[model samples]
Target: MRAIQITEFGGPEVLQVSDVPEPVAGDGQVLIKVDRAGINYADTHQVENSYLSKTELPLIPGGEVVGHTEDGRRVVALVGSGGYAEQAVAHAPYAWDVPEGVTDGQALALVLQGTTAWHLLKTSTHLQPGESVLVHAGAGGVGSLAVQLAKLWGAGRVIATASTEEKRKQVLDLGADAAIDGTPEGLKDRILEANGGKPVDIVLEMVGGRTFDESFAALGRFGRLVTFGAASRQSAAPIDSSRLMKGSKTIAGFWLADCFANPQLLGGPLTELFDLTAGGKLRPIVGGEYALSDVASAHEDLRARRTVGKLLLDPTR
Candidate 1:
């Protein structure tokens, strides 16, 4: 089997394609014939040795994938690592069968981002119907799914923030009531104006740093802000407890792995998420697809922020 390996932590060029022995299923693990893999900012961060977790040398950096399990069932799961390859293994407990009618690419796109957004909405914030939500990076992988799921959950108003005009349009088309161009200045004002001068109830803060502070200022009384990823590629800002006290607001951190560890708490939302997609309430946006050998280019595109929506790397492409 062939895989994309990062022998050293560095830039995109460090991701080289090479042949490797195939993996076999262990007692409870299932070996998957990988079809599509999702590329996230964390994957690129791992390559640059900037992520929260320690990188294993000669590592395969992909986190989420969709493919066929040993028994020929279509499935998707968070592999922790080793997904950027022709084949990989998934723990049977975490792996779920991809339902009929969902394409391999679409299922792969939704697995990670869909689960993240689902958990963020239902668990971290305990979002209520008819409440307002502000989703950052509204055109990116998780952001796109978050916007759609917010609306599906009966949110009265969904406001999304994008860094570019193109992303703004894309977010709006994905059912966001409003999509604001999140610049250094006037973004909060624009968001408030679009929401009829009302503050938001829940905020999905993916872009930390300066934008994170702006998100803090844009909240309503007793609102909640959940931070999942730092796509800003800069230092995160210090939190002022006093500032949070002013609005009686709350700040929380979220990661799928953390939620997955407590399955009893996550079981409900995970079911709802897959049901929403199966029922046609949510659809994933696939922006680009690359072969496993083009792993370098995939990282380059994600790191440069040139790609929109979910990026999938097909081992068979």
Candidate 2:
């Protein structure tokens, strides 16, 4: 079998396409003949050894797979590794059936980013309907889904921030009430102005550094902010406890790995996402596709921010 192996972590150049024996399913695991895999920002961090968790050497770096099993179940599953290969393995509980109409790429998107977005809203924040909401990186994988799902779940006003006009427009088309520039300068002002000159009730923040500070500052009294990523690869300074205490503001952090540890909590949202995709209500924006041999190029594009939405690799191509 062919897999993208990272013998040592550094850059995209280290991701080598090489032959390795296919992984077998363990006693409680399921073997999947991987058709496509999703390339994620976390994959980049794993390669650099800067991820929140450590990754072993000689790793096959992919997080999710959309493929088949011996019984012919077309499923989307979360794999810890070996997704960037001809075959991968997943635990049975984490492997979910892709609905009849949801395409493979869409299903693959749901396994990681989609589920993260879902849990951010449903489990972590418990967002209330009719509250104003702002989502950073609204054009990317999780942000795209967050924007749409926020509106679907009944946000009174949905605001999205993007680095490019095209991306801002992309989120608007997906149901954002307004879109704003996500630049570090005057970002809070822009978000405040976009929300009709007031602070927002909810914020979906993933970018760290100045962006995190601005998003936290843009929250209204009793506002909730969920931090999911640091795509900038930088951390924000510690929040002033006094300020949060004074304003009744709350900040929460979520890691997808935690969700993986508790699969019992995912049954509802995963089923709904598949149903929504099958019904054409929720959509995963797939932006780029690469052959398995070109995994390094995919990583290069991702690290360089040269692509948008969900990117995929066709292991069988």
Candidate 3:
């Protein structure tokens, strides 16, 4: 089996395709013939050993894969690793049947990034109807979905932040009420202006550092800011308890891996996301697709903010 492997932690340059032995399925696990594997921004961090979770050496990069099982059942599975390969092992419980009318890339999108967007709104923020929501990196995979989901859930306003004008337009197409510049400079003011000179009721913040700071400052009373990723690779300032008390604000952290402990958390929302996609209510944007051997280029494009929506790798290529 050919797979992308990393023996050292650094950047996309560390990813190298090698003809490695195929992974074997363990107890309660099944072997998957990899068709498509989802590439996330977190995968970029994983390669550099800077993600929320630790990255072990001699590791394969991807965590979510859409493929067929030994029994010929098409499924999308959230594996620990080894998804950047011709074949991989999938834990049975973590795998779900890819419903009819859903493509492989769409199924892969719903597994990690899609579920993250869902949980960030439904579970972490406990978003309320008619609440104004701000989504950072609005053209990216999770942000694109979050914008649509916020609208579908009856949000009063959906303001998005994107790096480029084209990306902003894409965000708007995804149903954001407004799309603003993502740069930290004057970001708070832009967010407020977009929301009718008022602070947002909910924020889906992932970019850390100044982006996080600006988003936090734009939150209204009783606002919730959910931090799921730090794409900027910079830490935000320490939160002040007194300040939080003053505004009744909340700073919540969410990692999709945590949902693995409770199956319902991942499974339930995934079912909903799948149904929405099948019914044509939810659209998953596939920004780019690369061959398995081009995994390094995929990571590079993601880290450089040169891509949008979901990215995938075709193992058969």
Candidate 4:
């Protein structure tokens, strides 16, 4: 089997393609002939040795995949790592059968972001109907889905932040009530204007550092903010307990990888997301596709923020 491996942590060039032995399915795992893999900022973190969890050397950094079983059943899963290869293994409990109407790319795109967005709204924030939500990186993988799911989950208003105008427009098309420029400067005011001079009820924030500060400041009383990712690779400033107490606001964090420790909470939301896609209520936008050997370029583009929507690796391409 051919796979991309990072013998050492560094940049895109470290992702080298090499021939390796095909992995066999374990007791409760299934060997999947990987067709597509999803690239995420977390993958970059692993490659750079900055992930929250310690990773072993000579690691395969991919986190999600959509592929086929021995009997040719189509499936998608959050296969922790080793997904950027021709074959990988997935725990049977977390692997889902791809339903009628979802493509490999679409299913792969949802493996992490979809499930994260689903839990961010339904579980973390306990989002209420008619509440407002502001999602950062509104055109990226998780942000795109978060914007739509916020609407479907009954948010009265869905506000999104994107880096470019075209990306902002895409977020609007995805059911966001409004889109704002995602610049660190004047971010809170822009969100305030987008919200008709009101703070929001729920915020799905990924960008860390100053962006996290602004997003927290833009919340209304009793507002809940879920910090999921730090794409900027910068640390957010410490929170002041007094500010949170004054507004009765709450701040929470989520990591999909951590949730894997408890497989019990995994399948139900993903099944619901697939059903939404099958019914045309949801769409996981695929912005870029790269060949297995071009994994380096995929990492470059994604790290440089040169793409919108979910990025996929076509192992057979």
Candidate 5:
């Protein structure tokens, strides 16, 4: 089996395609012949050892995979690691059958990114009907899905922030009521303006530092902001408890890993997401597909913000 291996923690440069032994299944796991591997921004942090969890050395950097089991059942799975390979092991409980009408890319999208978006709104924020939502990085994998889900769940308005004009248009096409420049300059004002000169009810914030600060500031009374990632790798100032109390604001943090302990967290929403894709109600945007050997280039593109939507790696290549 060939896999992307990193012996040291650094950047994309550390990733290398190497012929590695096939991973064997454990008691509660199943062996999978990987067809596609999903590339996420978190994978970039994994390679750099900056993720929420620790990264062990000599690692194979992938957690989401779409593949076939030994019994020939096609499934999309969330693996602990080793997904960027010709073969990998998946926990049986974590793998879900791919519905007939869904493509591999769509199934891949539902694994880590889709579930994160689902939980962010349904779990972390407990989004209410007619509530306004602000989705940062609306052109990225999770952001793209978050935008659509928010609309489908009957949000009053969905305001997205993207880095470029083209991406902003894409966000709008995904059903955002408004799309604004993601640059820090005038972000708070732009968000307010897009929301009819009022603060948003909920914000899906990933970019840290000033972006987080501004998003927090733009929240209305009883507003909720869910922070999942710090793509900017910058830290925001500590929140003042007094300010939170004054506005009745809530700041919540979410990580997809936490959902693994409860099967319903990943399985239930994933089934819904798959059904939505199959029924033509939801669309998974695949930004680009790369050969397994080209994994490093994929990381570079994602980190550079040169790609939109979900990215995939064809392990067979």
Candidate 6:
């Protein structure tokens, strides 16, 4: 089988496509014949040694794969490694049936982002109907899904922040009540005005750095701020206790990989996410597809911010 192996961490150039032994399913695991494997910032971070765990070199960096088992059942699997190959191994318990009407690429796109969005909504924050919410990176993988979920879950005003006019329009088309430019300091004010002077009850923050403090300032009394990623590549900021004390704000962080390690807590959100997609309440946006051989280019595009929405790597290619 062919796979993209990251032998050393540096740049996308380090990702090389080479032949590797086909993976075999262990007793409690299943082998997924790879179709499309999702590419995320986590994969990029892992390759650069920025992931929470120190990664072992020569690693296959993909996480979620949409494909079939030996028996020909359509499924989405969350695997440890080898997703950037022709065949990958996944724990049986982590393999989920793909929805009947969903395409393989769509199914693959949803696994990581969908689960994260669901957990962010149902676990990280409590949004009441008629309350406003703000989501950063609103056109990116998790942001797009987060906007849809917030709307479906009955958020009265859903504000999405995007870098470009095109991305801002994309989120509006996906059901965001209002789309604002993420750059300007006026974003918080725009959100505030859109909600009729009510501060946002929940903030789904993926962009850290300057945006983090701005998000904190935009929260209403007793509001929740959920940080899922630091797309801005900024250092962690020290929390201002005075701001929390003044506004009754709460800060929470979520990492899906860590959450998955605790199944007892992850099970509910995982199952609910799948159910939402299967029922047509949530949709996955697979914006780009690339051959596995193009792994380096894919990572380059991701790092350069040249791509939008979810990216998938076709391992069979």
Q: If scored against the real structure, what TM-score would every candidate get?
A: 0.95, 0.97, 0.98, 0.97, 0.99, 0.94
- lDDT by residue for model 4 over 1-317, one digit each (tens)? 88998888898899988888898999999989988888887888889888888889888778788888998888887778899899999888878899889988888777778889999999999989999999999899988999998888899999999988888899999999999998888999999999999999999988899999999889999999999988898888898899899999999999877778887577888889889998999989999899988988988988887788889887776
Model 2 per-residue lDDT tens digits across residues 1-317: 98898889898889888899979889889999988899998889999999999988979899889999979999888888889998999889988888889998888777788888998988778888999989998988899999999999999999999888888889999999999999889999999999999999999888899999999999999999999989887789888799899789999999988867678666567788889989999988998999988888988988776677899998876
Backbone clash pairs in model 4 (N, Cα, C under 3 Å; residues 3+ apart or in different chains), count: 0
Q: Is 1 or 3 the stronger prediction by TM-score?
A: 3
Candidate 5 global TM-score = 0.99
Against the true structure, candidate 6 reaches a TM-score of 0.94
Model 1 stretches astray by more than 4 angstroms:
263-268
Q: What is the lDDT of candidate 1?
A: 0.83
Question: What does candidate 3's lDDT look like per residue over 191-216, in tens digits?
Answer: 99999999999999999999999999
Q: Least accurate stretch of 10 residues (summed lDDT) in model 6?
A: 262-271
Give me the displacement of residue 135 in model 3, in angstroms: 0.4
Q: Which structure is stronger by TM-score: 1 or 5?
A: 5
Q: Model 6 over residues 153-187: C-alpha lDDT tens digits?
A: 88988999888899888999999988888874666
Q: What CA root-mean-square deviation does each model show from the true structure?
A: 1.7, 1.1, 0.8, 1.1, 0.8, 1.8
On the 0 to 100 scale, the lDDT of residue 245 in model 6 is 88
TM-score of 4: 0.97
Superposed Cα deviation of residue 261, candidate 3 (Å): 1.4
Q: What is the C-alpha lDDT of each candidate?
A: 0.83, 0.88, 0.91, 0.88, 0.93, 0.83
Model 2's number of clashes is: 0
Off by over 4 Å in 4: none
lDDT of 5 by residue, 21-102 (tens): 8888989999999999999999999999999999898999899899899999999999878989999898899989999999
In model 2, which residue pairs have backbone atoms overlapping below 3 Å? none
Residue 145 error, candidate 2, Å: 0.4
What's the CA error at residue 51 for candidate 2, in Å?
0.7
